[model samples]
Target: MITLLLSSHAQRIWGERIAVAVPPGTLSFLTAEEALAAEGPSAADIAFMTREVTGKSSPSHPTPELRGFDAVVEKSPNLKWLQIHPAGAERPIYRQLRARGVKVTTASGATAVTVAHSTLGAVIAINRRFPLLADAQRRHAWEPRLAERSPRDLAGQCAVIVGMGPIGRNIASLLGMLGMRTIGVRRTAEPVEPCERVVAYEQLHEVLPQADWLILCCPASPVTRGIANAAAFAAMPEGAHLINVARGEIAVEQDVIAVLQSGKLAGAYLDVFEREPLDAASPLWDLPNVLVSPHTASHSLGQNEAIFGIFLDNLARFRAGQALRNDVDNLG
Candidate 1:
């Protein structure tokens, strides 16, 4: 019989459907709380994680509930697979689990559309100078000074997009509608849709000077951690803008601060930071050329339901010994 470990909330919400998918007497269940309290390693063969325990957590800070979940998974002596929620495999715990030979599946493409749209929104907001206009309105001033600080046209400009995953690809497609040229960057250099050309990650600097805008849409990983450092900023064309919708680890915050201070970059729209709740005295708050967000780029409706469907489908495939849709390797 297949033994499954899950969160208490998952059992309450989808226990019946899970049971319906599997034949009676063919599977047994153990909740995360039960696993943690077990005498020895909870002999669970599969662990199903949802947003309940995975949501609202970051690398710098994990919620108590999230820590507990990680502890349970780590202690599972027989855990062969983990059906985790959307894009959560970036966690260090998951890397450890993968090193231990446990299979990890995710609902990666579930939030692609939502995040892609949000990223496009950030690009547009910065392109049209919404932050500057908002500041002008705050003073009740009619400062549409065309000669000074005039917004440039997006058409005929270049965009260098890093990490061309589902979200990145979608962002490129949207950018194309605005008549902007796109260059995609990823592990592989193969050409993709809506991009003039694709380059390997190592060639990042080769194309930085050509970018009018640089967008970070990659998942946080060993290769991507601190990928955007001071040297990267130095390579970009003067007055280039930046948009980071990915995790904060992808860019060095201190280096980002330095570049903004030096006016090496025209402006930056950041949704993630190296530290969560960004310290009160952070220079990012006072940077006139930066737009900061609370890392809510993918906060859209119906995402949870979509991820749930991917998990359920994968569960049925697991029972049938079929290939899972979003089975993962090393998360990134």
Candidate 2:
């Protein structure tokens, strides 16, 4: 028998489907809490967990004394695979899992459509000054000049998208429909359909000045941490917008704040922050030109359903001894 552990919430959402799909007596379900509390040894063969269940900064349950996914993995002696619901797996966590000889998979493409839609919405909101208009409405001030508040159109604009992954490609396609040209940047200058042209990392600076919008959709890696720094801001044209739907550590917060304060960039739509829950006193919260979301760009009504589908399909692959989809490269 193969024991599959899931969070109480995940079990509620996908339990029935999983039970129906897997052969009888071949699988058993255990809530994350139950699995973590198990004594001595664990019968679990696979674990499906989200960052929340893994505990971002601490263990999920105080009694069990597990201090994050690493602790959970340490206890589950029979665990062979881990499926993370999020697209980007934290480097440290990935390393720990790999060291234990456990394979990790991510739900990378599952949230692509929702995240891409959010990116497109942010681009339009920044260009059209939607926040400013909303503020005007809140104050009950009918300012006629609001229409002239530097609102720009998407048509004929140039967008430079960093990272040519599934989310990036979807954003490019949506922007293309608005008549915007997209230039994709990746490690290799491979041909991506939604992009007008794809360039390597070395050419990022060369194309920055021509972009009306710059979007970051890359995963967080050693090479990507703080990739967008002061020099990158200086290379962009004044009044250009930035949208970050990728990991927060990819851009330096202080540099972004400085550029936004100096009006070097018109605005920024940030869905993630270097430090999550974004310090209560952070100036980015008060910036008129900035739109901040609490790292919910990938959230949608269908998110759970979509992620469950990915996990379900991967379960079949695991049973058949086939390679899992969206397997983490585990470079560390």
Candidate 3:
């Protein structure tokens, strides 16, 4: 029997689904709540660290209780596999889990459409001057940006998308539907669909001058951390907008603020941040040119079921002794 370990939050909502997926008598459950109890399951072969944290969880912030369960898992000498929700696994907990010989798989592709849709919306809103319009609405003032200061057509404008992962590709495909051009950057420069061409990370600066919009959807790898800094922003065409749906460490917060202040970037939409629940006193909150979301760009009605599906599918594969999908055990 495959002994499964999971969160009480997850098991409560998904207990029936889990039972249906795994054959009767083939699986047993030990909730995280029970695992944390003085007398818990002595050993677990698999862990499903799921959460219902829509607005409460940020990619940078794991649920407090869930994060604490790592110790319980480590002591389970038989644990061989685990599943996580976040697309990126840069968090230290993941590293620690991997080091303990657990095969960590993630729900990376689940958020693609939702994240891309929100990112594209941010682009359109900023282009249409929604922030200024919102402020005007609050003051009951009549102010229209027409003629001289009117927004230009998005067609023919270039976008430099970092990462080229599921999220980046979806954003590129949507941008193509809008008649926009796209350039992708990642480990290799090979061309991907929708994007006219692709460039290696080493060539990022070479393509920045063409960007009307710079979207970050890359992983938080060593090469990606803090890649968007002052020097990088200066290479962009003036008035370029930055939309970061990727990890926050990829963009230096202070440096981003500096460029925004200097008008090097026309605006920015940041979902993930270097810090979760971004400091209330942080200028990002008050910046007229910035749009901040509490890492909720990926939140949607179907997201929970989507992630659960990945887990169930992988659970079937695990039961069959086959390789798992979205496995990042060997990844950095």
Candidate 4:
């Protein structure tokens, strides 16, 4: 039997589905707490976790009751594979897992559609001056200035999508449906569909001035960390909207604030922040031109099921000794 250690949140969300996917007596499901307490030979063979499970706190129990994922990994000697719900894995944890020769997989494309939809929504909200209208509504006042400003339309507008991954491609396709021109950027300039043009990372500056909207959908890596800084902001055309559905570390917060302050950017929609639970004292909360979403862009009614489906497919592949989908390439 394949012993799988599942996070309590996963169990709560997709326990029935998981049980049905893996036939009776073929796989044993153990909560993280249970796996940590298991004896040598009874330890888990696979760990299915979310970002919460990898955190400093335990998702199943209080911190005092259970140690974090590192401890779980150390205790579960039989663990052979790990499936993380998030697209990117923490470098340290990934390195340790790699050293142990454990195969790792990620839920990369599972939330693409949701995240892409959120990005397009943000673009439209900013262009249509939703923030101004929302502020006016709070005071029970009718605002004609919103209309006087001549809200921009998506038609004929240009959008630069950084990363060109599944999320970026989905965003490009959605934007294209609205008559917006989509240009994609990646490490290589390899052409991708739905994007009118795809350019290399080195050409980002060349295309920045042409974009009415700049959407960040890149993965967070050492090379990409803080790629959006003062120089990048300065290269963009004035009043261009910024949408970040990717990691907050991809953009420098201080630079973003500076650009907003100088009116270089018309507005920004940020779903993620450099520091999560974004400090209440941070100026971003008070910025009139910025919309903050507490990193919930990927949330939707069926998000859990979509992610679990990836796991189910991989489980089938595992049983058949086939290569898993969305396998993580170890970063050297």
Q: Who wins the TM-score comparison?
A: 3
Best by lDDT: 3
Q: List the residue pairs that clash in candidate 1.
A: none
Give a tens-digit lDDT track for model 4, residues 1-332.
98888777777877788788876988877787665566554377987776455443322222432354556766777888888777666446766886788888888898999998898888888888888789889989887754558777789999999988789999999999999999998988889998989998888999998988889998887767888889998889888888988888889999998988888999999988787767799888878768999778888877766777788888889888988888776322
After superposition, the stretches of candidate 3 with alpha carbons farther than 4 Å from their true spots are: 39-41, 53-63, 330-332
TM-score (C-alpha) between model 4 and the true structure: 0.90
Misplaced by over 4 Å in model 4 are 12-16, 38-42, 51-67, 146-148, 330-332
What is candidate 3's lDDT per residue for 191-237, written digit by digit as tens?
88879999999999999999999999999988999899988998999
C-alpha local distance difference test of each model: 0.85, 0.82, 0.86, 0.81
Per-model TM against the reference: 0.93, 0.92, 0.95, 0.90
Report the poorest 10 consecutive residues by lDDT, candidate 4. Answer: 57-66
Tens-digit lDDT string for candidate 2 (131-237):
77778898997865445565777799999999888899999999999999999998888889879999987788989988888899998877778878899889888
Residue 105 of model 2 has an lDDT of 91
Q: Over the stretch 121-166, how does candidate 1's per-residue lDDT look in tens digits?
A: 8778877778777887988978773875787888899999998888
Better of 1 and 4 by lDDT: 1
lDDT of 4: 0.81
* Model 1: lowest-lDDT 10 consecutive positions: 323-332
Q: How large an RMSD does model 1 have?
A: 1.9
